[model samples]
Target: MARISYTTVSPLTHSLNVTKRWTTSLGIWGVGAGAAALLFLSVTPLVRREVLVKVPVLKLYYEDTTPASDKPF
Candidate 1:
């Protein structure tokens, strides 16, 4: 009978990372919204209103001047 010898293997280790928390201030968003509102108010009057004019179609052909050779059957 032969005796078998087993060796213990070491486990792998991973590094842990820590990140800082990010935050936003309300002043920037408020100023941006205010500027956008001011720009929209200032540009509103520059846009012109569209007006459509209806016109009648004119036909300028006489039936009496039709040639016999060029007339459609």
Candidate 2:
């Protein structure tokens, strides 16, 4: 004949283990979310300024009777 023994954890220990697991998971998620927010904020200014820059222009001078051949092509 064989006898088996089972040990049970206390209620306080079980509650502590559950709380530890929840806090650890929450901390990991919070760090990831914070990093994503910082990256977004850092990149936003560069993207927003792209549309506000002006293009360069050149000025030309010519006579009313200037022929097409005399103009800069």
Best by lDDT: 2
Q: On a 0 to 100 scale, what is the lDDT of residue 48 in model 2?
A: 27
How many backbone clashes are present in model 2?
A: 0
Q: What is the C-alpha lDDT of each candidate?
A: 0.41, 0.61
Clashing pairs in 1: none
Model 1 gets an lDDT of 0.41
**Model 1: CA > 4 A from native:** 1-24, 44-73
What is the C-alpha local distance difference test score of candidate 2? 0.61
Which candidate has the top score in TM-score? 2
Cα lDDT tens digits for candidate 2, 1-73: 8999989999999999999989989999999997777557644645324421221221121113558999897
